[model samples]
Target: MTRRHRAGALVLSGMALVLTACGSPAATDTTDAVKAAARQSGDTVYPAQVANCGRTVRVDKAPERIVSFFPSNTELLLRLGLKNRIAGQTWTDQSPPKPAYATDYRKVKVLAPGEIGREALLAARPDFILADGEYQFDGKKLPTIAELAKLGVPVYIDSAFCPKTTGTATLTATTTDLTALGTLLDVQPAARQATAETRERLSAVDKALTGRPATRAAMVQIVDKQLYALAGGLYSDVVRRAGGRNVLDDTVPKGSNFAPLSAEALATKNPDVLIYHYTGAADRAASEKWLRTHLAATAAVRGNRLIAVPAADFSELRAVDGTVTLAKSLHPDAF
Candidate 1:
């Protein structure tokens, strides 16, 4: 769901991309790092090794101070009952993942919508950091997870945004992330509960869609004046699960996730539904107006089948809720 990619396994020795993802299981240094990080974050300490997002990261114990570098990461942390452990958060553009407790976490540090220097992050001394990737991170300074690891800080990235990932994004991948994070944080129960609940929600949606026909659709994300067609990555998974078939699935190689959408081609192959991703209410209105005025003759527009999704929704842990919303909207008669 994040366009920016964080550094991946290629750079890490013995990552899933290399050496059978093997490394020293856990050394004294690992234990020491975990203890120290725990003290800073005020969480319990334990040791764990993870092959995450194609890379290996060792966590000695539960972190007390966890920095969430993306909205989705923040949502995951909160949903997993680690809100108090949040040392810092980025991407504070919309309603926070925990609106009811926004006032409670108001003192948490913010580090985004602009450049975040390595020094600033180090000063926060977070034990762990969760990020979507570097795709959206740009400003006066850029920092890599590799750099943080060197300083004894561990970073976990959502594999959905990994550039090296092959094929479509799967619900399995999201569960894997949750399981791995929970294991590392000593909160496996919470992770399992969250994943199970998400599955149950999706199952309910599936039941509602049992007799429904899927709509022909296209999911598009427009950024920097460029259109990115949703082929078979995270967004497509949502579309498919919601009873829609992406029209752009065959536009590219089978394993490729997304590519620049061709406007002319879209004009000719206009779909039954066009779901546009936009950030902020203003952007949503503008994007819908532009799509309607520019392609009013298309069946999707003429029939008012344009679905405007908040761009930020897909990044959060509750993203599946958005899928259910889409399915219900597309098949209002079913419910």
Candidate 2:
């Protein structure tokens, strides 16, 4: 069987073991007691089972020590008021925590500037781990999901980065993830509140732009002079929710998140709005200038409709904020 199939089988087998254990009379009695206590205290039930990626992550209790592998995952935890639970975090050098989370983010231990080595991760004594992508558990440079399971550590991967994920992310999917995290962490109330707030904000955006036409837009990144456009996935969803249509959605292959675009192709599409992502203001200015000089014939350049956004905003948790930002830019009068 292929590697993916093998991994799926392993996950299914592990879930079966979990179900078997929970089925035992002693385990069921304890679980019932815990649930009764939690209900009395108005807390989430114990042993929350969340389907993550292709694995069923069974959390018997809220994790006290969580190692967040990406800024997006870290931010989500912080948003849920679980800053104290984060034992360590990584990948904050290029994209620092959002302004609202800056203080709490600073207090967390920096496991590494980029990917933390397996040794450092284990040293943190993390009871739970949150990763933004499947690439983190590649098993060569880092510990795989099965390996972590063997060590009694449960890992949750963002569905947006799941291997089988395709098309674009939706607000519903985003809230589903938030709800799952909340259940696993025993913070269902907080998660529900956050989800409500997100829906309300997006609903306002939708109400405002109800009859307005969608602006044809394209999100692109310039690296060493080559141009890459966001063709699908979270960014594409952001654009769609923000009263803009991603011009490259139909141009790129299905399930492709990003692809290099030729000057000719970009000029041919001539999107109404061009969003250029960058790490810093200087980089943003440079990218805009490059696009203007290289694809001067495009409507985005000629009409001065170029918008610059931080590259970090394209992440899972931040995509909501990204949508709001893009909507304001695309339909300034609506807001």
Candidate 3:
């Protein structure tokens, strides 16, 4: 299961130091002038407020000490050039910062390898927290947003993971979060540039696939020996944008993105392309072997259309990258 889904089930249980030194009067005056100019230019204003996951979060200034609860959220901050501000981060054994972020990722401290408890989080002394979803603040093993507010810490949950969000809005949700983070972090310019680039790449894929028939695809993963197909959320969105139709999209129930799949159902659906995601090469090989052995009769296996995608791509800022990668695989001539 995806981290989001896992965390949802566990709901019952769960910056850079800006160095400031006393400076000369002239230096202080210059700093004040710069602040005033920034305000006049409509840059990020202090005490910026936004409603996040039903909580009114207010940031008095760009966060200096940040605790990111998930690798995906950490990657978003890295993209925004806020790496130095990240004081700590947490990730599961299966999830790590993407290779592109390896160098910078090593600079930040890991608060824990897996789920962090309330005490560890408090020890980080974070002024702000970037969480994957509201599920992280379950008020059981983790601190609730209300509790954090009393301590002057504002929490920002990725809008894509907000409750009642639909798979169709995945692209919009990510771009929206990017814009909002840019505003809150005083990185509007960088955010705008990133957002534009993301849209441009997606647009290119759409243009290339225009008037073409979508390939029948299914994203499947083995969890505890059970086959689960992606029914909605970012994975489905990636398939849709890549000129492929998710055969299991309609099978997912409301508020969920995955559904159990049986061998009979797999053969019945008979997706033209079978997509599986993994974190490592070994895992990829294992999944591919499993598909070949168990579902050999399916058209996808017979045609050798099994594609392995990095699991991180489906959950992080790399969703666009996933879309492009899948597009190339599904419609090679178009790409």
Q: Which candidate's TM-score is highest?
A: 2
For residues 91-169, write the lDDT of model 3, one tens digit per residue. 6445556788878987889999778999999999999998877777889998788899889888888776777674444
Give per-model TM-scores: 0.79, 0.85, 0.84
- What local lDDT score does residue 213 receive in model 1, on the 0 to 100 scale? 80
lDDT of 1 by residue, 176-202 (tens): 788788777767778889889888888
The list of candidate 1 runs beyond 4 A from truth reads 1-45, 94-107, 134-140, 252-254
| Deviation from native of the Cα of residue 86 in model 3, angstroms | 0.6
Candidates in descending lDDT order: 2, 3, 1
Q: Distance from true position, residue 261, model 3, in Å?
A: 2.3
Per candidate, the number of residue pairs that clash is: 10, 0, 6
Residue 68 accuracy (lDDT) in model 3:
86
TM-score ranking of the models? 2, 3, 1
For model 2, how does the per-residue alpha-carbon lDDT over 1-335 read when each residue is reduced to its tens digit? 73323444555555567777787433334444444555555466656788988899887778999998777678889999998899999887547678998898889899998878889989999999988777878888788998897887989887876767745555566787888888888787788898998898889888988999999998899988899977687778888889999998876667768788888888889898899888766787899899999888888888999998877776656777888989999999998
For candidate 1, the lDDT comes to: 0.71
Error of 2 at 159 (Å): 1.4
